[model samples]
Target: MIRVERVGPLATIQDLGRPGWFDSGVGIAGAADRSSLRLANRLVGNPEGAAGIEALLGGLELLAQRHLTVAVTGAPAPASVDGRPVGAASVLEIEEGQRLRLGLATTGLRSYVAVRGGIDVAPVLGSRSRDTLSGIGPEPLRAGDVLPVGPPPRTHPIVDVAPVAAPAGDLLTVRVVPGPRADWFADAGALYRGEWTVSSDTDRIGARLDRRSGPTLDRRGAGELPTEGMALGSIQVPPSGQPVVFLADHPITGGYPVVAVVVDADVDLVAQARPGQPMRFRPC
Candidate 1:
């Protein structure tokens, strides 16, 4: 068992998310950077879909109630046990009553922490992920919360160290495929040419991109179009002319026109992109 000593700005338990529930109006609410979660679970010999803690911008501290192995992945952050520095992306053993601290992220936006046995939280609708948008599953982590760890798997951890990419540099080039409503916009080509900056208002629902000296998209369709099913990574353009890239917690359906959809390979980059980070879309 692990007890939350201090809750960071945002921390929540997440698994692979509840898929095939869109018909019930539930969006797939999982870790923003799923690749990090999978890697963390693999480092600790847990299933890829095991529930773990997702720390936003780091600063999470926990106290272990029992001896267990843990792995930290995603966002390059400083991790320590009882003030002694520990390595990220590698498994570390913690004794009973030891305190584990995850400091502010030096790069990237979200981090994943996986215990050896995985977080044994109660599942809701076939998932342990918290849906911030629809209020489904467990609540976000708070101080004094106790997290139960499950029994360890029989198979031992395979890798000694797993290296994962942290979001870097000033500009991130993401690939986009023309969305179904692409014809609703006057100029879809401008999305690939414009260098848009990520807005501060970005969240689990979506990442809003600022036009920043580029031409705003002119809508050719009526504003009252019927709501249609939305997908992850769908770049929906609002009346303001800015594009919002849908994330894991986005609405299942939206009325806004989708100009393009970010490629599946690059959606993780959107999760790590910080406010004011410049990005360009490349249509493939």
Candidate 2:
């Protein structure tokens, strides 16, 4: 078991997410960076889908109540145990009463911390993920939270450190395929023009990309379109012409037109893009 000493900008217990509920209006809300969460779990010998803590912009502190193996991945946030510095993406032995702390993220937005055993929170809808859009799963972690750790898996840790490229600090380019409503835009190619800045309003539900410079995407046909089902990576363009890349917690339906859809793998990259980061969309 471990206790939350302090939580920074945001911290939530997450697994892969509760999928297959779209028809029921539930989005697959889980770790913003699925790859990072999985990597952290793998380092600690836990299943890739094991529930762990997702720290937004770092600043999460935990006190281990027992001996445990742990790993920190994503965002490469500065990690320390009992005032001593530690390395990210590496396994560490935490003794009872040891304090594990993560400082502010220097590059990416979300950081993942995985314990030997997964977080044993009661599941909601067969998942331990917290959907920020819908009040589902465990609530955001707070100080004084006593997190129960599940029994460790039969498998044991084999790797010591997993080296992964840190999240990008410069402009990020993502691949996109044409969206269903691409025809609605006067020039769907507008997505490929000019750099898009991640808006401050961006959240787990969607990433609103403010058009730094480019004509607002005007629809060919006037009048509003019917509310259509929206999916992860669905790049919906509002009347303002800015493209909003839907993330894990995106809504099930939207009325705006979707000009282009980001590729599946790149959706993870978009999730890590911090506010005000420059981004470019490449038509695949």
Best by lDDT: 2
**What lDDT, from 0 to 1, does candidate 1 have?**
0.90
- For each candidate in the order shown, give its overall lDDT on alpha carbons: 0.90, 0.91
Candidate 1 residue 45 Cα shift, in angstroms, is: 0.4
TM-score of each: 0.97, 0.97
TM-score of 1: 0.97
Q: In candidate 2, residue 83 scores what lDDT?
A: 95
Look at candidate 1 and give me any clashing residue pairs.
none
For candidate 1, write residues 1-284 as lDDT tens digits. Answer: 99999977899999989998888888889988899899999999999999999999899999999998999998877999999999889898999999999999977888999999889989999999999999898999999999999999998998878876667758889999986888888887778876999999998899999976567677776655699999899999988888999998999999988989998888989998988989998988
Question: Candidate 2 clashing pairs?
Answer: none
Query: What number of clashing residue pairs does each candidate have, in the order they appear?
Result: 0, 0
> How much is the lDDT of residue 68 in candidate 2?
86
